[model samples]
Target chain A: MFGLMTGQKIDRIPVSPFAMGYAAKVCGFSIGDFYANAKVNFRSQLMAADMHGYDSSPMYGYASIGAWEFGGKIGFPYEVGHGAPYVIEHPVETPEDVDRLEIPDPSRAGSNPISMEVAKQCNALGLPAVFQVGGFITFAGNIMEPARMLLWMIRKPELVHKVISKVLAFQKLTADWYIDTFGPEKCMVFSGGATESNKLISAKQFETFTLPNEIAINKYVLDKGIHSVLMHPCADQNANIPHYRKIREECGWRGRYVWNFGPETPLEKQIEMFGAHDIIGGNVDPPSFQTKSFDEVIMLCKDNIERGMKNPSGYILMPGCELPPLTPPINVHAMMTAARKFGSFE
Target chain B: MNEEILNGLADAVIAGDVEKAEKCAKDSISADMDAYTSIMEGCAKGMNVVSKKYECGETYVPEILCSAEAMNAAMDILKPHLKADATAVPKKIVLGVTKGDVHEIGKNLVKLMLEAAGFKVIDLGKDVPTEKFVAAVKEEDADICALSALMTTSMIFMPDVIREVKRVKPSIVTMVGGGPLSAATAETYGADGYAKDASVAVKVAKDLVRSV
Candidate 1:
């Protein structure tokens, strides 16, 4: 993965499959156990990485961990098949809630201790840990009503900024802690799930509200000597891709990076837009991963690999986002097989 | 002068200025302009411009949201003046995110666009149960039911919700959308229509209503 990101030649295409939920199934653990217990999370991640020959292990836990730490109500399911937990109550309801908000200490907050422990375990196992943290906009959405937050961006710009500032502070602290403990070289910061799709927010709004904080968090990791900043924006974020170039320029980011495009973004367009970057990760339709046949999945993977290789940038075979928790294992195997057969650099 | 006021009302909505929208609405009423005329020619017309800009990638969520707010403010002033017959019949829509999914931005945007297109929308909010969708449809006599889900986990609930709605009233058109859904999935789940985004949703809802 590092070799691909640094413009060095590698024998084959790097494949770091973002299989969080599928990993749990591989280790005979439930999604609930996988998320709540650090040991189980680490074991499943390692087992899945080894089984699939994944290049890196993703350290993604419950999406609402940070929000839960800061006073949001998160509900975890007990049974394995019941699916992942969700936020039942948001911490912020009104503009005044922004003023009342305080950053949670990363060392002791809700699930951060457990998550950090999992990262430590991964590093101890010699597995490269990609510490995935939620972006400011997504974390804010988790802690507050998402639609109200977007409206607040227009009606109460100051209040929105106030909330975002607090979230960014917490994000920076979390990133710093990971860098301090795991060391910058072994760690990659996946600051993602901004959820600010072009369909949802305009380029102007993205530039004004979302871009600054993205730059801040990415810059924080870069300054600490972390070269790989993996950005995962879900859904159709084709419009937001150009803004990332601006982010690269403003932050003076010279390090390796991965840009994961959503399904709506065609591979040709992704190559046209970001082919000059270090690593281009995706464009696979997540729904198809759940519904398509194994042969179909392999065909899709081959098509994407062929088109993605057309650009000089190193390509990683990954889902557009996290694989659907119920995605069939055969399809994932087919993806790796396709990558190896067609993605040989030699 | 009346035409100028109506144009100003549309311009206010396009600019997303709530106060300006309200003022122009009041001026239209005082000038004996038909409230429906003001809404169609002024507020909705302005929203049309916003929608165009949105489609052309010239505008985004925040601007569309502010414009929705501006249109609502104008509607508040003009609604009281509209004759009972003129306002009595607009197609009604029941909208919500599926159970276990708290994502509401997509649902809310669809609601806003549907309203701007002159539909009466009843938003059931996020994490709504399948039964609630059935209840809303039966009670509101809705012409369409729109379901949204952002997670793959939550998307499984969509087929159940669609089934419950069909059981209650097979006549009511059902539409589904969100981050993880595609038109094929929507068809597989038995939805009448699917839209990738809010702008397309409005047109889909209208077409669904007409087809029904």
Candidate 2:
């Protein structure tokens, strides 16, 4: 993956099989422990990575991270067929509640400490300590339920902005703690934007609510001498690309990143709009892992590799999002098999 | 004067103005307009336009939600004046986010549209179990049971709920929708209908009611 990132010649393209609960499900571990216990999540992901031979490392995070981190409650997966952890009650209910919120210590809040344990495990193995400061707007929504906050975009936008600012503060505090614990060179930042999908919110809302904080996060992370920053802009984000283009001038972009796309943004269009110089990955429909057979999975993966190999910078293959927990095991391996068989330059 | 009041109510809803919608509804009652026509012709008519605009990508969730609020506001003001015939034999539908999923945006949108279209929606809220759905169906004598799940892991439970509901009462229709599901998946699960989004869900439900 580093070889592809730095423009080095490689034997074949790398594959990042985005696994979370599928890791625990395959490794004979409990899904609840995977999210609640840091050691379990790291080990489960590492075991899955080893088994799949995918070019990735274990990272401790989940989509529902911010809710628990910011003084809310969540329920971790306890049984098979249950999804990832989810927030039970948002901390902020009414507009008045936003003023009453406070930022907790990153060292002790929610899973931040457990996340550090995963980072320690990574650092011990000579891998980068990855910190999850992704999803500012997602966290904001988690603090005050997504639907309520989304309505506030029209009804009470000031409340939404207030929550976002508080979230931004918490994010920076978390980043500062990670950088101090492990130097920037050894730390990788993982950020995502599932809530900002055009399916839910308009691109205009994305620019107003999510774009500035993301720009702030990128600048803060990159200026710290941290070279690695990979983003999985999940779901319908084709409309959000122009704002991304706008940030280059605002942030003095030191762009050497491989932006991951989903089924919404076609591989060709991302390459066309973002340019042919940076490493690009993904657009593999994630549900295919469960719904399609092995042969079908390979055909879909081979198509991704063939079209993705065109850009000069390079290509890596990955699931459009985290694989569904019960996705067939054979399909997980099919991505690597396709990469090995069809991704080679020779 | 009746046409003028009804048009005013529809225009307020289409414009997504809660204040105007309330005023229009109150004016319809002051002029003694039929309550059922005000809802079906005025408020629902405006929601239909909003749904079509959303289908064409001209508007989005924020605007759509506001429109729903405007229509709901008008309905609340006009509901008590409704005649016995308009309230008679409204079909009941039990809706929920299937167990293990907490996401409710999709389900909530569908519920709003269903209620606006005159269906008696029995909302079971999030992370609902299969047995609970069957119980609701039997308890309410529901005509349809709609299930939603946002994640693939949780989505696996859809067929279980569908099968159980059918075993208990073979005549009840089952509907499913969410991020991971398709029409093929719904059919495979023995669901009578599948809607990709909330707007389409209304049409599918109406069709399912007619077919049954």
Candidate 3:
């Protein structure tokens, strides 16, 4: 993974399936247990990494720790095994509510302590850990209603900024704590889900509301010498890739980030647009991976890999987003096999 | 003069200005304009423009939501003035995010679009069970059942909801959408129709109602 990120020749392409709940199920734990128990989260991730023969283990299973601590009601449904906990209640309703919000301590907040322990455990195993944080826009959306957040962006820009500032501060503190405790080398991968994709927010709104905070969070990790900052944007964001050039021009982002294109964004277009960057991953059809045959999975992986390799930057074999829980394991193996056979460097 | 009022109302909705929309709606009512014409031409026209911009990628969710809010504000003013028989006979829609899915934004957008297109929508909100869909269809005498699921896990429940709805009210057209769904998946789940987004959802719902 490091070799691929650095534009160095590798023995073969690094294929890491972004499996969360699916991984937990493989380790024989219910989704409810996985979210509540640090041991279960860690074991599941490790075992799933081993089973999938992936390049690395993700440090966090659930991404709602911060929101949960901020008083959002998180629910672990019994039937949705290993699926992400849904926010049953939002904490902030009005602009004034943003002022009342408090940032929870990373060492003591809801699920944060458990997730931190998981990171420590992953580090002790000499595994490179990918610590996931919800992006400020997503965190803000989680704490408040998404529509209300967007309206506040227009009606009360200052309140939105005030809340997002707190979110960013909390994120920085959490990142620093992880870097301090787990050691930056042992926890080399840092990712944030900017799921508030351009598909939902206009490019102008993204520039006004999302870009500054995104830059701050990414810069914080980069300053700590973490080179790989995966920006996971959900849904079709094909129209918004040009906005990244604005980030490069304004924020001085020099191609250290990897862009995870959502499934709807065509791979050929992604390769044509973003393959010149340091690292660009994804564009696999997640629905097909979950339902299609192993041969189809192999064909999908091979096609993506072949297209992704056309750029000199780097490519990682993976799904457009996290693999759905119950995605066929044989299909995952097919992805790996395809990477091994066709992704070899010249 | 009523045409001017209707035009102003549509412009307010297109601009997503709630206060202006309300003011124009009041002006049309005071002018004794037909309430149906005010709603269809003024509010729905604005939403139609917004939907077109959304389809072309010139606008997005937040903007469409703002426009929806403006349309709703105007509708609140014009609804009472609508003739009893005219308002009573519109097609009904039952909309919700399916059970196990808490994502409401997408579902809410579809509701707004459907309402703007002149349908009466009964929203069941998020995490709606299969039984609730069937109940809503039977209770409301809905012509369309629109379900949304953003997660793969939640989408698995769509077929169950569709099956139950079909069993109870075979005449009700079932449609499914969200980030994870494709037309093929919607078909595989036995959905009568599939829409890729809210803009397309309005057209699909209209077509389904017309077919029925």
Q: What's the DockQ of model 2?
A: 0.70
**Tens-digit lDDT track for model 2 on A187-297?**
888888578777778888889988898888888888877777777788878888888666555656575777787776888887775654567777798887998899999
* Residue A255 Cα positional deviation in candidate 2, in Å, after optimal superposition: 4.1
Tens-digit lDDT string for candidate 3 (A1-346): 7667656668888887878777877777887777778888888877888777877565664445446767678787456522687676778887678889998786776667777777778777766556666366677877776778877777677888888888878777888887888666555544444346776787777777777877676667767866556666666666666755455445455546676768777766766665666566766888788777999899999999888877567788878888887787888889889988999875
Which of the numbered candidates is closest to the native, going by highest lDDT? Answer: 2
Instruction: State which candidate, 1 or 2, has the greater DockQ.
Output: 2
What C-alpha lDDT, on a 0 to 100 scale, does residue B157 get in candidate 1?
82
> Per-prediction TM-score, chain A only?
0.93, 0.96, 0.90
TM-score of 3: 0.94
Question: By DockQ, is 1 or 3 better?
Answer: 3
Ranking by DockQ: 2, 3, 1
How far does residue A96 in candidate 2 sit from its true spot (Å)?
A: 1.8
What are the clashing pairs of model 3? Answer: A31-A82
Local lDDT at A219 for model 3 = 65
